[model samples]
Target: MTRLTLPSLAALLTLAACDAPADGPVQDPEPAERLATGPLTPAGPAQTVTADADVNLQHAAAVVELDEIQGQGTLTAKLFGTAGGDPAMNGLYVHAAFFLSPAEGWRVFRIGDVLDYRVLSTGPGRVELEIDESVMDPETSEIGSRTRRMILGWAPGAEGAPPETVTVTPAQ
Candidate 1:
């Protein structure tokens, strides 16, 4: 079975960090017209959590914080787990949180209780997260993974309004 060692995983994380936008928000290439959404092609590696862990143990596997344009606020992506029940029930969940103003508070939404997810790319107010689904071989008792992309869009409210919209859709 293939295993992700700490050194290798660290290296991958480092490479991912380098791909993040540094100057400003990168404009999304997709057109504004939303298509008939469905699952996109699976891409990237899977972020897996052992299902043989202790209950009540929580772990933040990955966290990415990006500053949006002046008034757009901040977008944070996290892959975390809180194994409070059965050890076999441990999972890596994906979530996005948007913060505009102190008065507005942070808007949070759960992407999914996926096996894991990777931050594919980020922009001004958008994040592309790849959902990593795990597959198990009954005969071999081995686990494998497949990845599909999803976009988390956080649009700013008009005229500095407190309410903003967050959407999760299959990435093109």
Candidate 2:
């Protein structure tokens, strides 16, 4: 056996620790091979997802379901007190608001106003929301308003779907 110098020994150790070359022929990546198998088979099936991917996908779908509700128009209508309160004002305010007006903003509408409100889900199949009477001095508007949560139905019944109407009255 030949005597080895420190430098030579270090170099030999480095070579021995290097990663090995392909055992034989280069194999196709799992994903690529999966894709080549058949159209019915998913190249990257959810079942085979890494723990991170599974967790992230579960969260991402929930977010998408949540975001779907913003599309409906703004306009809220709810019969809070009594149905016979006023036939004319019976339906939603003629004008509707999809999004809530600023904490204090004014949108004028006739009492008999009818507007399509986006209903929100409160419980399974059932829905509920409170209408807050924004800062509207009674002196400014004809009728004083109050905000109360009104239980309503979500039409076409589906999770995360918008409501048929939402009711908003100026704060009393």
Candidate 3:
């Protein structure tokens, strides 16, 4: 038997990230594609929500949102239930989703009454986002069920997002 060392594993992971589908868009995702087109296998640890932060209350229906980006801003939303109707949301529901297929470009994945997508991943005009698990229904299958691999095909920052700001400090 052969075993891969740490360096080998790291190298493989990095390569996978680069091959990840970014420019792709979800024109009209198919049924089967929904399941397979998941977990890009190259994303950072997504922070989980526990019914706090911005919004809450997961009713029988999901609450979706299309974050309003100003210029180069990042859409950061919160997940978790407050005090609502449906208690079934306690399970592993899609709190949020970030879809972007070769055809779609960069459209955020959301659930609820409406599909409020938010662009996070950036590539020339794209960005990476940690999709929550509040808007997922592995049981539902209605064709346009969800934006599995959706994308944003238009002028960068079409959402009128403002220039983003990030504070960085070097470690000793």
Residue 120, candidate 3: Cα error in Å is 6.0
State each model's CA lDDT, in order.
0.58, 0.40, 0.39
As a whole number from 0 to 100, the lDDT of residue 158 in candidate 3 is 42
lDDT per residue, candidate 3, 1-172, as tens digits?
9898999999999999998888866477776887687755746888876754444333433433334323333533232222333433323232332234456533333222222233455443333333222354558832232333333322333464321322111111
Candidates by TM-score, descending order: 1, 2, 3
Q: TM-score winner among the candidates?
A: 1
Q: Which predicted model would earn the best lDDT?
A: 1
User: lDDT value for candidate 2?
Assistant: 0.40
**Better candidate number, 1 or 3, judged by TM-score:** 1
RMSD of 2: 20.8
CA lDDT, candidate 3, residue 11? 97
TM agreement with the true structure for every prediction: 0.42, 0.20, 0.18
TM-score of 1: 0.42
In model 3, the worst 10-residue window by lDDT is 163-172
TM-score of 3: 0.18
For candidate 2, write residues 5-112 as lDDT tens digits: 999999998898786674699876799788887668456747654456566566334221011223233433222221222433323332221223467343222223
Residue 57, candidate 1: alpha-carbon lDDT: 38
